[model samples]
Target: MAKYKQLFLMGLLLAIVSCEQPSPPATAEAGKVAFNITSYLQQQRQMLETRQPMVLKSVATQGQEPEVVETPDIDWEDELAVFEQADLSRPSLQEFYTRQEQVLEDGSTAIEFTKLEGANPQVQYLRLVMSPEGKLKQLHARLEDKNIIFFSRRTINLSTNPQTGDIADYHVEGVQKMVLGDTLRYEVKANL
Candidate 1:
């Protein structure tokens, strides 16, 4: 009877210790779980800086006529910064999105990441298409931010030259609304 009591006490202590053990920290899996948007944009910025591509830019705000300009002196980093918002490689976001890959009928591959229901990530949807030769051909993303005082929704679309891997054209359009203020609409497009 004494031995049985000792064994039971030992089992209870073991169970308590096991239950109190800390869990391991979450980590992103090795090897490209998601497309590295920031790296791609950095490469694009470097290439643009060296080559100084001509850009045709158009901007419109609040229902006004779009003003267009052709220039080579534009700031590449500032222009491409918005696209970086779609990056989902953060460890905290690893489980918040659902990723899917499908091959298109045109011999291209499409990969997408979408925010799961009940997740409050700002980037709701992101899609990337690659050509048969594994070159990025297009990218699209939808982002939104809302609070008691301000709300904004933006959609970004980008097309690239598959062979050269250069940005061919890109568009960003959005709407913003503030509490007790008029809503504003804006659009920006650039062709390189």
Candidate 2:
């Protein structure tokens, strides 16, 4: 009985530590950059919730004809909902630092984050570039298995509404190669 109670308490503690919620930024630039990520995620989530229609173009790496599907016919909300959750506070991001101050010709900054130790699936690193006002301009992420041959990378470039700082159009490109399988490549471009 005592052992059972101790085990339950330990499990609860682990869950609490693992589920730490994200906090807002502490500095002006950091806050703006973080806010951009949060806002973009929230917008994506809202789009999913509202079931906004989109045209998705998918093609194989072997140069097959792209398959264009208008989204209301095939619900893609379940897939896009995942991106709505992208935030600076995800457990996978650790030791974020300002790697470069002038990533853009206009004197914007780029922040880099090292993957957390023992992070599941192993992310190599993540980078976010932002405008002076803290609007996100681009994001890049790489994932790799050092012990094996699997590797993947994703990049997102966004254009925002100057007045609202909301994403106006964005492009996402990614490539993945599994340890025991063929490589896959995909790209998405959407405007709002």
Candidate 3:
């Protein structure tokens, strides 16, 4: 009987550590997660819930034109911005929109944006988008409420850092952090 009690206590202790919940998965709706996606991608200020690579893939469908997904080979200096009011609020739609890359980034691309709306101007949102070609696309947003100034005043940025001397491909990391508010930071690092 004493042995049984000791075994029970040991089991309980094991459960406490092993059953610790993993961080929450990041969603495209808001840049938030419960866990880290990877150790290398982890950060002191933020954690990656997801990482996606960028690769154009063809779609096969019946009774339709063969969808040959091709990211236009653009000259970094010549490709004029073809989109107006292009928004990253919608993961899929924004992915489609960015398909016409002014330049091919690394295996993956990350973007952040603030001041998003759901059809109505009054509705505001925020998200950090991650696109991994052929695998998965991800997004994360903060716990937000509509009809507030925080949604409209926050700023977001997306920038790419090209490897010196080589511009065709590079790494991308950006954050959609709101000053004083819940700052959702997103950044990634990968070996070449």
Candidate 4:
């Protein structure tokens, strides 16, 4: 009788353990998010091929005083090519497979990726914000190069026409620190 009671308890424990829910495949979901972001960027690239040049302002400062100097407008005709040349490669995409996805309070979605495997292995993070329909809305990236003790950040915000799905306007801001012992900052805002 005692042996039978022990067997019953073991069976109950096994049943409860088997009924527990399993975790979702995070990597696969992250990959899907990354693919969506890449597709949206590709669409933007195609649109940029036919758009006119954009206006930009640049500034630079050195040392700790943080003097802000605003420069005149500059034509940014080659920025699209620069973005394309980055070549969202396979390894970089793999990094996104480990990212986290969340929905913001404003009903937008955000995907964030971090690569801090080592002190010098591109200690960086990429955050992408998109609309519910998967349109790219904003992108922010921070990258650190430990070898040279350099840091850089880029922020881009875009608005699109609801009916036509065309870009209405965009603003881009960038900063680089300790780049060959100099600091630089730039901002670009354009209307389509």
Top lDDT prediction, candidate number:
1
Instruction: Judging by TM-score against the true structure, name the best candidate.
Output: 1
Candidate 2 lDDT, 81-175, residue by residue in tens: 32433345543243343323446677777776654555544445556777788776666555443447777666545555655555455556677
lDDT of 1 at 116: 89
Clashes of 4: 0
Q: Give me the runs in candidate 4 sitting further than 4 Å from their true place.
A: 1-27, 30-33, 36-42, 49-77, 81-92, 105-107, 117-123, 145-165, 168-181
> Candidate 1: where are CA atoms >4 Å away?
1-32
Task: Give the alpha carbon lDDT tens digit for every residue of 54-105 in model 4.
Answer: 5333333333343333332323345443233222334544553246789999
Per residue, candidate 1 scores C-alpha lDDT tens digits across 113-173 of 8888999888999999988887779999999999999999999999998788788999999
RMSD values, in order shown:
5.3, 9.7, 17.6, 9.9
Alpha-carbon TM-score of each model against the true structure:
0.80, 0.51, 0.19, 0.52
After superposing all C-alphas onto the true structure, candidate 4 shows an RMSD in angstroms of 9.9
lDDT: which is higher, 3 or 4? 4
- Candidate 4 accuracy as lDDT: 0.56
Between prediction 3 and prediction 4, the one with superior TM-score is 4
Q: Lowest lDDT 10-mer window, candidate 3?
A: 76-85
